[model samples]
Target chain A: MSEESDETLLKRLAAGEERAARFLLARYLPRVLALAQRMLGSRSEAEDVAQEVFLRIWKQAARWQPGGARFSTWVHRVTSNLCIDRLRVRKSAPLEDAALIADPAPGAESRVAEAEQSARVAAALQSLPERQRLALILVHYQELGNRETAEIMDCTVEAVEALLTRARKGLKDLLLKDAAFDAPVKAVSGERQ
Target chain B: MSAAGLDEQRLSELLAAYGADAARWPEEEAGALAGHPDLKSKIAKERALDEMLNAFKVEAPDAALSARILAARPGREMRHGTGVWRALMSALWPEGPVWVPMGTCAAALLFGLYIGASGALTAMSSDPQTETALLSLAMADSVLEENWDE
Candidate 1:
């Protein structure tokens, strides 16, 4: 039933109930995918990460004991750790390989501008140190409370707050610089016109 | 300056971390910073950044992705049976052919029926040599005495 808790669903899942797995996938797959997508910035990689995350969950369901970390928190923690590991691997990848992960295509003129802005924001987010990026993503994008974000990150609440402060400041500076550069280009085009 | 009595420095920290939305702030701190004329400009700045961050919207996962993830679950095949007997069979022996267990049960039943119908136990008990062999196996001593009086 829709009212069933995650723990109950997991117990059913351990008993090999297909419906429970479907329910869990319906509830968490999108959120998990979004978290992975935001962290990895590549849809394919995000999908791989999501697959691994669910695989872990399926394996863990049989052994999962209640009264420990909440299921959602554990999911977030798993996703965060996997993303961080992938990011570490990406760090060793070639720069040209990094450019191969393309952004989504733009449609209309306004859409193009919006897509570019979104790309810039995503790039700024990726540029942040992993912890700061994760902290921001968990709290800002994932809409988790600071306490939960702290739990996911395995840090103190104060540490999460500090990471977020730096993350926001860093993101702001990057976007502001981008806007400043765009201004000069617009001014130059105006002068030519 | 606010209802919660938050100082300017603390308010700035909250704004930088949680942005302009009071809903996102801690319960004790939410709405305490709103409507403060002095903090309006500060809130406006954080709001601008939040708007930029909000632009990076991730699309929902496609059906193919969900299918792939679902396929990775363990014991997926075990969930397919609807019949109680079929489920019991699968639980009893998850792998190999169904005929394997069926044949085993059939062999056991036939052997049991054969033993019952043949009166094998009574025949074995009446034979003196069989009894003597059985008693020797059961007893620790090898010495046997013949009953000449019988």
Candidate 2:
């Protein structure tokens, strides 16, 4: 049914329904891919991680317990865990995977300033400890609630708040290092008006 | 309960800790700073940080990725088994490289053989008394050997 819920679709998927699988892929793939790309900073690795995640979903669909957790939350937790594991591996074997950071900037050099800014931010983001980066990505980018993020990170809501504070401060310090604090938010707000 | 709100100091702390997004600020303190002109300047600073954070974006995945992943789904049928077999299969045959199953199978076979062979060897070499009453027989034999020397 067009109105079918994720839990219903999962039940159908467990029954080996191809259409159910397609529905899920269409529904969640982009979000998962974005999450992976943001976390890993590499398109190829992100795709690999996304594919692995779905494959796991397919295998585990049959045993999925619906009410225990929302399917989206479960999917996010899996994606985060996979990304973290890959990051840890890359940390230990830096030489082998160190070349993945050369993410191609979209559009041409006409937007050189914007491209440089994005690159600087991405680099600073990548420089954060995995947990801190994860905290920012989950709350700021992914827009997950503190409760959901705490569940994903296996920490308390207070801990998530603390993480957010630390991550925001860390990013601000890094951005400030480049002398990019040209003006405060008020100036930007005035300009926006 | 007189609709009290956060003062400048508390407002700045909230902004610094939660960024400029009032939506993310603690609900109780969120409206506390509302309509307060004094904190507007501080709120703007927080929004600046949020904008800086928003500058980074992830590129959309290529369309082909969905197709590729869908195509690679495990074949249609999922087999069920006895509880022990299911646990064993899931652990040893987790979905991964084709080689993992082979490696685990080989390891499990080797382990099984080692245990089986060692058990058979023990059974073969064990004296009847040792097999039937190992602790008592060993202790009695040790005492007998010591008494013989006496």
Candidate 3:
């Protein structure tokens, strides 16, 4: 209903109301799916992870405490953790984790040049160590507070800051080398958004 | 700006709120974000960098996927249904310490009734001599039954 606040729905959900659960699932599943797709790089895997995240929320809704944390934040943390676990298991192929380190820079050129630059940056991100990838995603992309990012990363705020700094610096060093931006960049978008 | 223009805490706060909605942030930290000169560039940097990070859009589960995940084997569905009921009950009305004593007393009362009923039925169905002896024993009580030495 138009008058239902998230907390009210969450309370109903905690009380095992199926209608509230359906509402919660409808409201948040897209975001969870988007996050899983971005982090895990596979639609099938993302779908699986999204289902698990929903079922988990449904099963454990009673454990939630109101006014404790943002529901989105909690769900985002769970989705991120699940994606990381899936990524860790894909060790067989010659994947493009660090392929952006080899991409060209954007010289005095067109929007295509900017796209190329972005492509390199994206490549550099996937290449980083998993912890650095997560820290960067939380702070730089998701814009989570340092403390929240640290909590999601299961580390200290100081560690998050350090990881951000390293991730950015690493990206810069890789993206800026050999300033001649004449190399033909790939037309594909990054693996994750 | 001086070299000591921004503290580390303020810098982190500025970076945290730069690209995101300021309203979602704590007021003190949001104030720091607004006050800091570098917030815009840091957010721009983050935005640009985020683009380079793959923007993978995950697909939602289709009916087939949902069907597979929700499928149960044998009597598993009934078990899960019961579990859901238990979860709902626990959430609605948490159990306290009273259940233990209530259960124990109920069990004891049930056991006492069982023993008394069994003894009576045995006495009723027994041989005449045995029944008379038992009846006399019951009437005379502990003195005859225990031999009274102690």
Best by lDDT: 1
TM-score of candidate 1 to 2 decimals:
0.72
Best by TM-score: 1
TM-score of chain B of each: 0.50, 0.41, 0.32
- Interface RMSD for all numbered candidates: 4.6, 5.7, 8.5
lDDT string for model 1 (A91-116, tens) is 79853222224257677787987787
What is the Cα-based lDDT of residue A76 in candidate 2?
Answer: 91
The number of the candidate with the highest DockQ is 1
Q: Please, what are the lDDT tens digits per residue for candidate 2 over residues B10-89?
A: 66666766777867765666566667787765666567778877776666666688778876777532332447765566
Give a tens-digit lDDT track for model 3, residues B1-150: 332455756665444433334533433455444455645555555444344443322234465654443331122233224566645543543322234545888999999999999988876888997776777777976655565565
Chain A TM-score, cand. 3: 0.68
The lDDT of each candidate is 0.78, 0.72, 0.58
TM per model? Answer: 0.72, 0.68, 0.51
* Two-way TM-score contest, 1 vs 3, winner: 1
Candidate 3 accuracy as lDDT = 0.58
